[model samples]
Target: MATNKPQTSRQQKHLAVLIDADNAPAAIVEGLFEEIAKYGIASVKRIYGDWTQPNLGGWKKVLLDHSIQPMQQFAYTKGKNATDSSLIIDAMDLLYTRRFDGFCLVSSDSDFTRLAVRLREEGLTVYGFGEQKTPKPFVSACDKFIYTEILRADAVEPAPEPATAPVNGASQEAKPATAPVKAQKVPVDFIAKVLDDIADDEDDWVQLGAVGSNISKLSPAFDPRLYGFKKLSELIKAQPKRFELEARGSNTTGGKDLYVRNRKPGK
Candidate 1:
């Protein structure tokens, strides 16, 4: 009998971080990396913009610091945005290559909304990050959408001016500068679709894995990474009042586990 050799398994999560320098702030580039680091190793980091424009001056410095490849697109028309077209074409090309596990799209523009949806249709994760002003279409297009303002990259809260009232004049002490209120912009439509899909199933409370699968079916570019959560469990946990979790059973294969879910509050 000949000795049998065990084959080695190759596994790794490869991520691509593509930035629309025109729509994103250079100040948040480092913070973007910090967010992407939690997902998986970023094998490719590229920023798309017109190098000739002075608007991209800040991006030039950050690109050198982060080793991000700069893709320069010239203006083909006076008023039309050419960079967006170039980036979308490149994204489609990369999708066809099928090399990356996920893509991080750092832009607030809704123009890439279709691109995000298309990538997910091909079974690739998409992480979207932008300012709070990002449109509903773009936000809902991703598996998870994040607002960069919450990260507080540039804005620093100043200390409140002390009260000038005499010690005897005021009995109450002055309050220091309270932290800014961070809004949790819930993807109501997306969440509703997921819940509805799960409810439609034979089991009212479907497995979390199944919910995620349904979400991907509904939107291919869905990724939990963009929401400052590495795993779906964490994202759902953060919205406890919106979701309920239950342990269904243990796994006997490949070290995978299972669970069930519930609706968000007021739903």
Candidate 2:
């Protein structure tokens, strides 16, 4: 009997990336663009801020290097954030154009929470990037939220050198080095629950891809990188006690399919 094949390739999405220069750091721009490329082609890249102010001076070189168009919104009052309003208006204008499949809203402010929700309601995916302190509502509203700290360049630590030999013909024992700290652990229980909820009952196994999708839906900021793993499969495999993985042959695609299931109790 011929087996049915599943579609594995994703359609490239067109995205409009809008940045709030006031709330985001200039250092993350390179990493931000690199991260955005993983999802789709950025057809429109724009940043909003009051260009005349000295505070936004840092963004000048970054904008030129990335070719991102700057949309100036002068502060009309003493303490009002006019940039948010301008960005929201432009986002709506772009939404009406029906040209983009998604929007990347770069800001840590909760002001964009409603905008994200509204965009998703209209069938547009929203990818949010912000600091760890970003509001939960804004993070949850996005389809996927990336912590800018992770996107920034990692600090390099120099490796310890080999111990030197003593001149008295007696070799000294090398001092034991302290182990490096581990990355924060992901919520495995929550992840397993999500997988179980979406798994097929026949075998209690879920497609790896499906599980990844559901996890993102449940927690927009759920990323494998948080656990120091480069990919979701790697992260899952690292937790052998919590899950089981199997690789099956694909019928139509001539590739292997990965299936996963939560480990049985006491197994």
Candidate 3:
């Protein structure tokens, strides 16, 4: 039977990456770009911050390596954040150009929530990168939200071995500045619910890809990496007790189509 399927080979998207240097840490820059590449070509990369400040020194060091143009926005007032304003203005200007397929906003500040919504209203995808502490409004505003903690763990260069130093009047090795943080456990209930909702009948086979899409819709911040799995399929396969998997046909992505079903009480 002839089937109507969308093209498996997704066209490379053009993205405008805008970074809020004050809100985004420099440690995640390498990983940030790597993640962006997965979505599309970074047609424009610009960061907004006060360059003269010493705190942003780390970002300056990586500017040349990544070819990111720094947009200087000096702090004009004591409490006001001029960088956010500058970035938002530039984002709107870039939106009107109509050249980009999407926008990647790197910041944890909630101030960009409205900006993200405005851009999406114009039909551009918004990918937000922020820390775990990022406001839910901003996180929910983007089409996809990636926590920077993951990026730091994945891409930041590891620090050198610590030298012996005096501690509490005795010579001892200094402890590591960054201790490894454990990933949160996968939301099994959420996955089970999505699978059941999609299934036409009990034990009916459902496309894994469809379940993945529904999960994303329910939780934009849902990433298999959070649970230490590289892919959705890997995560599902790990929980064999609750789900059954079957392969029926080949797909365009050079991989076989995987169908999933809710496991019955027995066999």
Superposed on all Cα atoms, the candidates' RMSDs to the truth, in angstroms, are: 7.6, 7.5, 4.8
Cα lDDT tens digits for candidate 2, 159-233 = 434568787888786553222223566789898899879876877988899999999998999977766777889
Which ranges of candidate 1 are over 4 A from the true structure?
1-11, 154-267
Query: Relative to the unseen true structure, what is the C-alpha lDDT of residue 104 in candidate 1, on a scale of 0 to 100?
Result: 86
Cα-based lDDT for every prediction: 0.72, 0.87, 0.87
Across 1-267, the per-residue lDDT of candidate 3 in tens digits comes to 978864433247889999999999998898899999898889999999999999999999999999999999988998788999999999999999999899999999999999999999998889999998999999999989998888877722334344656778886755542333356777888898898888995558899889988887778888888787778898889889988888888898777999998787877
Runs of candidate 3 with Cα error greater than 4 angstroms are 1-11, 155-180, 201-203
Question: What's the count of clashing pairs in each model shown?
Answer: 5, 0, 0
Instruction: Name every residue pair that clashes in candidate 2.
Output: none
TM-score of each: 0.61, 0.84, 0.87
